[model samples]
Target: MVSTAAFLRRAFACAAFALVSAAHADLKVGIDLSSTGPAAVIGITSKNAIQMWPATIAGQKAQYIVLDDGTDPGKAVANIRKLIDEDHVDVIVGPNITPAALAALDPVAASQTPMITLIGSASVVEPQEGKRVWAFKMAQTDGAMADVMTRYMANHGVKTVAFIGFADSYGDSWLNEFKRFAELRHIRLVATERFNRNDASVTGQVLKLIAAKPDAVLVAGAGTPAALPQRTLVERGFKGPIYQTHGIATPEFIRLGGKEVEGTLFPTQPVVVARTLPADHPAKKAALAFVTAYEDKYGPGSVTQFAGDAAGVYPRLEDAVARALKKAQPGTVQFRVALREELEHAHELVVPNGVVNTSAKDHVGLDQRASVMGAIRGGKFVFISE
Candidate 1:
């Protein structure tokens, strides 16, 4: 119905508009991690997983801006402010440790940016109060880990246990859950102690623990630093069974603890032992898919459970963003708020870590099926069954 010149002119304008829309439509995600501090190993693995995520999410271009928080809570809070105020990121992920993640709650809620934390502290998102409404968690809860550990100890005739962990929130959460479950399992708590994550030694604490002569010991800490207490116990020639929380599932922890960590038991997400999981396991298929993508890049046996936790954010974000786009587009305050609401709507989403089904009442969303008992054997993680 139009002349050649008119049709050509109209087509050019339509193409230009499409290009402009594409340029401004990227989903911006900010990552604050402890890349240079004590939790560097965890941060590095998480960053690696983020780098491997698909360039596009739910048909929209995705852009990620990663910042190092150095594992400091103050730095983590500052990083969240910058991400929200300057970068205008719709969602923020991580600051590997529990303290950093907890410290970030204020800034995240102020900007209405959805935060997905990769820490084991269930309190980070529990109660789902004012600020917590903006936060979600990826790691399995300490309660879930404690339940598995206590059951394992009870079945193994561990009548009494000693507990030593970081003098921070991670340790507090673990101790509380372990105590609750241990009492129910009829296990006696003989001694309780704490140490700083960066303490040069835990000799004094270890001595007190050995004096109690408990049947077993539980170290509630994360990353390579968690190895200090258990390694010190072995050095002290205390030989009852030793257990750790899921936080120490990384290879760096095993390497740092060396032979001292052998036979050490813990509760971890099935992704850590995905290859050994039964074909019918709900998490097996998704976990194996991530393993293939990750190992293909980082080499066989280089994949860590931390990477699985980080990789989980991508699919969850993708699923939520897809639904959110129906109501809002990226790059605006409305988009950020909509993303937060949509994230809470995540239901039955399978990830390498677990099945996610977040809601107003529960943010972590993982159940007992998310945890499987594991032990460090011959410098590798192996699944343990009843």
Candidate 2:
């Protein structure tokens, strides 16, 4: 039989171990994406990247709970609620569609959870006031991409351009940003039109655009749906240069557009053309690492800009979690707040797509270094210029 003093010492040691274990509880990440609807191409690639993340982050085991939003805002909101209310996730990631990401804002903000979005639109995190303070974005903003695209057009003598985009928030953001940048570059906007993502024909829009006889045409849509307008333009015999936004950086866009998209140019993250990025480019090594790893698993030329954005989330979390662990244990309100604060303080943190330097004011922190002009050539995305 043990003496009373020895028994007391054993009990104290067990209690100490229990306390330590509680402090290092598993970190939970909830992911919601449009994995089965219109944005499936984008969401699938993002999911692929998320799959490659290690089982642990910053010395704590991580549990990832993924949900499909079906590219619907209602579904996204539902999924976010489930993640927050039921799962009690520490952080939320995704909802790659613009509207979906916007819809998720309330749930995350209400729960004081940090969200790292993979969507291209900046509106989700911009004006960093109100509920947006808890949100961050991994993709480069349309404004930044527009700046590069318009500059390229100016250099190439694209004096006048026609705009055809989605009939949704995604298109609205692109049109606003592109218009602002184009005007600054003296590129006249001759015509503007919009079409639904699921629409089978953009012939009417294409006819209006062709009638304008602009020097070039810019299609501001995402995923495979973006191909409809470009294909219609080519079919209708509008031969001037055609431009697309970074939203079309997936291989599905090229596959769907076929030869019609062969000469299409756009501004995209470095990872879309990782192998072709200049040796000294800041994101080249990181981009290549992602490309190699992703292609190794999913097959060559399978990676997309969405995948690159998702892959970057790991490094951001790793950086933030390391700091947050000191403040509070995972699975608690304090830990989520600490994670959000640390994420805001990111400085020169390099990810697969670009160098991030987020602040309280600017949540989507990317510069010219994050974008490169790319053209579809011989069925592949090739770097045109920085």
* Per-candidate local distance difference test: 0.83, 0.88
TM-score against truth, every candidate: 0.92, 0.93
lDDT (Cα, 0-100) at 35 in candidate 2: 90
RMSD of model 1 against the true structure: 8.3
Top candidate on TM-score is: 2
Over 1-386, each residue of candidate 2 has an lDDT whose tens digit, in order, gives 11112211221122111111232349988899889989999999998877777666777877878899999999999999999998899999988999988988899999999999999999998889999999999999999999999999999989999999999999999999999999999999999999998998889889999999999999999999999999999999999999999999998898888999999999999899999889998878778777877787789899999999998888788878999999999889999999999998878877778888889998887888898999999999999873
Q: After superposition, how far is residue 41 of candidate 2 from its true place, in Å?
A: 0.4
Regions of candidate 1 where Cα sits further than 4 Å from its true position: 1-25
Give the Cα-based TM-score of candidate 2 against the true structure. 0.93
Which stretches of candidate 2 lie above 4 Å from their native place? Answer: 1-25
Which digits, one per residue and each the tens of the lDDT, describe model 1 over residues 212-235?
Answer: 999999998888989999989999
Model 1 TM-score relative to the real fold:
0.92
Clash counts for all predictions? 0, 0
